[model samples]
Target: MDILDKLKNREEIYYPIERNRNTDLRFTLYDAFLAKKRFERFAPLFMEAFEEINGPCYYKSDLYKSKLGADVYLKLDSELKVAHSVKARGGFNEVMVKVEDVLKENGMLDKFDELSLNDIRKIMAAYTIEVSSTGNLGLSIGLCAKAFGFKAKVHMSRDAKDWKKKLLREVGAEVIEYDSDYTYAVKMGRLSAEQNHMSYFVDDEMSEKLFLGYAASIFEVAEQVASSGLIPSDDEPLHVFLPCGVGGAPGGIAFALRSFFKDSVRIYFVEPTEYPCMLYSFVHGEAASVNDIGLGGKTIADGLACSAPSKLVFPIVDSLIDGFFSFNDESILRAKKDIEEIDEKVVEASSAAALLAYEKINRPKNSILWITGSNVDK
Candidate 1:
């Protein structure tokens, strides 16, 4: 059976809480301006970093109206490309829309011509895939694969939430569930790509595309600071704290900060004490496995649960990261609660982890904290 048929055969997964279907999440014009300002402020930093690695690329920033208000969106400029949602916890459809926008913008409508037909049956095909946590990425990857005459697969852990798995199936990804966790899912995905002779691994953990996509966050922050008159003087370094999981986000941020600020800013990394692969690596002065440190622990922050550091990110971490901070689940939870109390907005446990560590470290005033994602399922 074809992917669409297979998706039709799969059952829909339900969640205990009522899912928010309203796409008109409200954001004030001022808020939109703030987000755009942030993007503009950081655009140069992102451009410079991306140029160093992958040449020139265009950027798109817009507010996505969702049940949770406006979400910031970003993408890489490529002939056949994928767009990623900033929300770490958004589901499949959100990701699909972003990819569709990219395809539409690039005028690559012909790429999907063959897949639009029902008669053609091909055993294997090459696909430009995009991946992220939850099933949202699966939807985009599957849709782009279908539109562009390619096959797509999404890797998810057995621990992945049930709704996410269903969403993956709905989006036409052959959802491959690993026996272990998300880290293992990534390893399995690499192997599966090799065995299937696929065009590329839509790797979030190690791919330059994925890392550079996130580095845009740093650019946005830099712009926000400068425009808001928050930029420190030349002699005063901007200390940046970021939460590390597989090291993609932190690695990207560090690369941008180091390139722009050089010795002007200090970069600090934060990881959950339960799965502190990055911290262990930093402390040992070399890359080390999570198993070697025996640091595994259960936490609500599943996104940060990485068993190993990415080989691609190690060099950047060694050179750019100044220090590391470790925090327990309790601290992350407290941070989440504190953010909610202060802003009345629920920040995910992982998102709050960086700010939590920053508070604990008591760094110099004006230090910047990278609030990575808003994927808190609760």
Candidate 2:
């Protein structure tokens, strides 16, 4: 059968392609450097806003020397303090960027460092932060919004977990449930935000702020990996397997890695078989959805149940990404189980996609499987 037919059958597949790496000039190393500096400037604000975070969200990488039998490490973002997911990196960064803009407009930017949490919250209360998500991003946005006293409205797709919705509500966000899929929720959320003057929408599909936030984290990733003595070279390439959703997080990461490591790293995105939107979009040379190909677009990996890849992200990372790995829910469940058994930690199905990719791919001397989030239910 053809690749499309194979994808339709929900079969496990790895499609590798030569990427031109230098094709996109819209985002550059300078952009990443600027984002890194911006993140550093917001460190104090993040700590003051979310006391639980303590400091900037730190990535925890554990080397599994015996388990994988190779130089493999799990970059566990699931253990992050604030939102307990990789989404917190992007979500919190975007919110802080917006907050910074507001503070500057009000002549409080100079005084921002001296302002108390309540002082900033009083200003933030005049605005609303909005977004649509399958789960994790919504939770991140809601938590960040309420922490800064901004009203939050999360448009949730039907596939979003009940626990995520409950957590969002508990954080004082208005959760609007949609009977349809992620695309529809985004459309509604965008429209609603456009109609309001005091609303800021964290567009998962198109927000450069969110993309930059994810991209900036790669600086920490590179530092952590280098500290562990696994530097990527010509013969010893670093293989990074990232879990994909609408392509924002993974795409940002892949772009930054390509800029940093150049040809020394092989970046792969892992997606649900039923919703391999990024893979399909990459192969077909256009923006398309799983629904366009008659797939159900539903999966146990709710965070990865996106119908279409992000239009903004896909084009930027199209030349940087090396390949795509698509797997069924059975494989995700099995990977999750294996991870919990081996690491004694529970991860969400979406996060387990990277682990499955590492297992399916050829054994590399150095590989990093980025665990995106924890299963809050567990």
Candidate 3:
């Protein structure tokens, strides 16, 4: 009912990471391997758009490690290229791959390849793509869709920030605002795309490309950690705290990390107390949504205002993540203010969720928190 009450109600859940999984539905090392290859294919597109993608963009963000009394490092998705958020990774990959899929199916692969960038624009302009989002994903999809000359439509819920909506419009996407939640926006986007043959829908709840794009971060994180000479052994385990909305970003990364580190890594997802959808879903063992409990989906962290866990990522989340925690709006603001004063870094509300989780863990030697986004309004 209240902030701390939500934390008190948390049902702790985790699964052991191993080489083989008995269940057909649960994710395994093979899935991580396949996801890596998918990411490699799209990583080039990311580089083409913004000089660099997976490797050069991620770095350590400044945080008050001593104040938290843990050796905490931040994976700076806040400074990532494109839309300055983790969403860009997934959104870009989904749009690019979808365009290619349509081209290949139409028997235009050779024709599409022969065209120059400007010439390709003419070929791409005839198609359309749509996606539903709270905010950041729309920015990524809209910007990427526009780049490839698609008539883009972004369906947004009331929870989306005004600046994000305006940004999508400025980038040539048809911005449709709904007086509803994310699920409703996504439903409408799906319907609209289904009505037209040339239209493609990037379903955030089920897009494997989006999941693969997020999983790609694992390679870079592993490389960066290895280069820094910090080995997370069984004695001193590695802890990573991440912000969760629809669960794709954290779930994908968790799947990869679990495969890479085996039992040495622990992944935790943090969320707005009112909208801890994934925690409820994992604990309930089926599907769950905030709306089922009469939540209107209000939160300061707009990017994390999803009312439900994504169906595609929920199974992987249940299989991979080590923990989940929720906090109130005030907690997000307090952490943002305190960390800004202490660390001299300005992070958005969703980005500060990792810091909230950091305080809750008794991590050993190595720990990394993901600063997933910073698309605050000016």
Candidate 4:
């Protein structure tokens, strides 16, 4: 069968349907309505995001779903070039998957797995690096290190969720807690990593792989939009608003959109007023640390409560994004209520923050808001 047929026939093992030998699982009309509503709400956003970025061809993979995240897929081009996955926390898993694919292609899968642990240790030792963060990127790297049989150390801010800290420990990572915020934890992690022998800091903050992998979301969005026939006319530009954490998602989406849309799409970035790293960066003409911002230390939007932007993503944001907006906690709460009322879907505060910004700024009718993830701890 052709690739298209294969994709169409790809059944989700987790949601199995019975055949003649058994029986097909039937869905009520209500179920169908809910499903359609979800698709209508999300598909258009994905499609427009992809088309404006000029992604021509792609395929979807089930990796993200397997991890209990969203049902995400990796996109590929006609030449079978793998572009990016739609996973929110695209960090170590993204890197490992690509590396493993390359190794498998070279007939070195077993050797690659065997060498990965030692290789990681050597690299860490060389760089004197210790990875630290309160976010998924750091957690993913720590998990990867443990999987590869390498020791991992992480520093998390006091405000970090308890579950995250527990998960880090469950993966055999050495976890340190800081009394201060994320930036302070990062500094402590860096200093400790530098002082210890055989320690290498896997600074997710500066890692090109992390930011590049995160950018892949746009490629999928581009392809989906093109396939859905929702590409905006050449005369009018699509406006895209992305929520900001450490500016990774905004930076990645902006970079891809810039490459695809050129001057045809206007990009806006939104961040919590409590941590407006991207907005601060844009206003300052360079990437600025949020450590000094009084409100930068905390937010109900845990995913977007980052106090600094990644150095790698800053340039992309500076050049590609047209505007930046900051939303307060009260506004985010109202936005969340509005989304739940409109779609009956539960979205995290981070995602709602983007919508709130759009409402506050009086965004264009043809605008797109990236509701990035639903990883709320509530």
Sort by lDDT, top down from the best: 2, 3, 4, 1
- Poorest lDDT segment (10 consecutive residues) of candidate 1: 72-81
Best by lDDT: 2
* Residue 240, candidate 4: C-alpha displacement in angstroms: 1.8
| Candidate 3, residue 58: lDDT | 24
How many Å off is the CA of 238 in candidate 4?
2.5
Show how many residue pairs clash in every candidate, following the order shown: 6, 0, 0, 15
Q: Write the residue-wise lDDT of candidate 4 on 104-182 in tens digits.
A: 6556766643553445334333222256665554555565555444567778776666776777688567888787877
lDDT by candidate, in order shown: 0.51, 0.83, 0.73, 0.54
Number of the candidate with higher TM-score, 1 or 3: 3
Candidate 4: residue 226 Cα off by (Å) = 1.4
Candidate 1 at residue 303, lDDT? 59
Candidate 2, 1-378: lDDT as tens digits: 798888878888999888775585478767766777876776776777666665665322343442654688877777777788888777877887888899999998989778888898999999999999998899888988898889999999999888888888987899999999999999999999999999988899998888877887777878777888887986878999999989998887888888888888998999999899998887778889888788756698888999999988887655777789998999999888887788777788888888878877766778988888764654
lDDT of 2: 0.83
Question: Judged by TM-score relative to the true structure, which candidate is superior, 3 or 4?
Answer: 3
Q: Candidate 3 — which residues are off by over 4 angstroms? A: 1-70, 106-115, 375-377
